[model samples]
Each structure stands twice: as structure tokens, then as C-alpha cells.
Target: MLTLKYFFEPNVTINYPFEKGPLSPRFRGEHALRRYPTGEERCIACKLCEAICPAQAITIEAEEREDGSRRTTRYDIDMTKCIYCGFCQEACPVDAIVEGPNFEFSTETHEELLYDKEKLLENGDRWESEIAENLRSESLYR
Candidate 1:
């Protein structure tokens, strides 16, 4: 008579919240509005992103400066409506907008997630280094 003996397996699962998995280079994540080196917003208020967005999550209102330079007076991106398609980043001619490697965007209210120009710019400033590093690291593989 043959007897089957099986040993209990140990828990091999990693602690996810503490030990997070690495993200791929192509991972499209939270959105940000970039700025120029001179501290001016990179967006020309062209509305290309608004038009190109399949979700229509982006809203842009433009106005001319005293020098006749166009800038976005009101730029809003509804995070609830965004699909993270990255089309907005691709549509931006001046690299004003980019998808950062941050997927931790969570809020208690929808209004908190609806990013305005100031909020987006702050995000860009905060995550600029990470975004640049990720881009550079990915460029090496390409």
C-alpha cells in the first residue's frame, strides 16, 4: 500500500503595503502639468490635450497675457474621469504634461481628486525628480 504524504507550504506571499512590487518603465500613472526652466508653465493653453482626451477629463481655459502670450487660466483634470491613457502627454508639444510613476493617488472626496492648475503644477514640482529619473532609466533600456 502506497501512502501519500504532503508537507504544508509556508506563506510565500510578500507584504504588499510594505513590500511593494516594482513598476514597469511603461507604467502610466498620475498626471502632472510641467513647467519651464524659467518657472513659467509649459502649457501654451492649446487645448490639444482636452481635445485628444478620449475621456474628456481635461478642461482648459486660455487667456492672453499682457505680452500676448497665451496661458491656461483654468486647467482642470478630473481624476475620476481619467482613464490614464497618456494621450495628453503625447499630445503636448512642449512636454508640458506628463504621466508620473505615482499610483498612490487616493482621496476621500471627488473634489480632492479633481486637480486644478495649481494642484497639478504642485504635483509636477513635487514629482519632477522622480519623473525625470524614471524617464532617464527607461531611455537606457531603449
Candidate 2:
């Protein structure tokens, strides 16, 4: 009876990497750092992201820039240690940090999982439109 039931069951698995799968609107995946419309970095070096990270995956160092603006000299996220609780983005006052839609960031080595400021910024640039749209939709409920 068990073998007969299995023989008639339809396959539920889809071809991934080609067919893809659906993701929720509020799905938290890779992280990114946003920028203002004026091309200035949105992060004020508030240390909120670092402080609020439950996994202690975030590390930040700030310095006064030449223009006297407080900027992060070093902002790194140890992705290996991240728990993806979405606390970092939620604690950000300026919405500088956001978790984007892309989740395909599989790395061959553990060292590659350490995300630096530049890499996060690059991710922001790459997924800005999607991130903004997600934020816009998310704000409607609040």
C-alpha cells in the first residue's frame, strides 16, 4: 500500500536556479547600505546597528571626515555569525541599513562571508529599487 501511494504521487519539487521560487515581501536576506539622494552615505555612524545586533555580527568605526561629517571608517558584518533577526535595519534611525531581496550570496569560502562597507554599499546600489519598494510596502502597515 505504501509503495502504491508513492508511485501515484506527483513531484512537488521545482527546478531551482532556473525556475526559481517565491519569496515573501518581508523576507530578510542579504544586507545593504543605502545612500541619500544627494549621493551622501545615509549612515550617520550612530553605532546603532552595531549595538543592536543580537549576534554581535556587526563592527563599526567612525571618524570625522574632512568636511566634519561623522562617517564610518570601518563597517563590517561577519555574515558567518549573523542570525538574520532584522534587528540592525530596524534599529537604524535613518534607514541607512536594509536587508535586500537577493539571497543568492553563496560563497565558496568562509572568509568571503565577511561583508565590508564597500561590499554592502555595492549591494545597496545593485538592489536599491527593490529595497526601496519593499520598504515602501512595509511602511503601509505601520
Task: List the lowest-lDDT window of 10 residues for candidate 2.
Answer: 16-25
Candidate 2 lDDT tens digits, 81-111:
9999999999999999989999999999998
Q: Which residue runs does candidate 2 get wrong by more than 4 Å?
A: 1-12, 66-68
Return the top candidate by lDDT: 2
Between which residue pairs do clashes occur in model 2?
Answer: none
Q: Root-mean-square deviation of each candidate, in angstroms?
A: 3.7, 2.6
Give TM-scores for every candidate, taking all chains together and pairing residue i with residue i: 0.84, 0.87
For candidate 1, list the clashing residue pairs, or say none: none
lDDT assessment of candidate 2: 0.92
State the lDDT at 74 in candidate 1. Answer: 96
What TM-score does candidate 1 reach?
A: 0.84
Backbone Cα, N, C clashes tallied per candidate: 0, 0
Cα-based lDDT for every prediction: 0.87, 0.92
lDDT at residue 115 of model 2 (Cα atoms) = 97
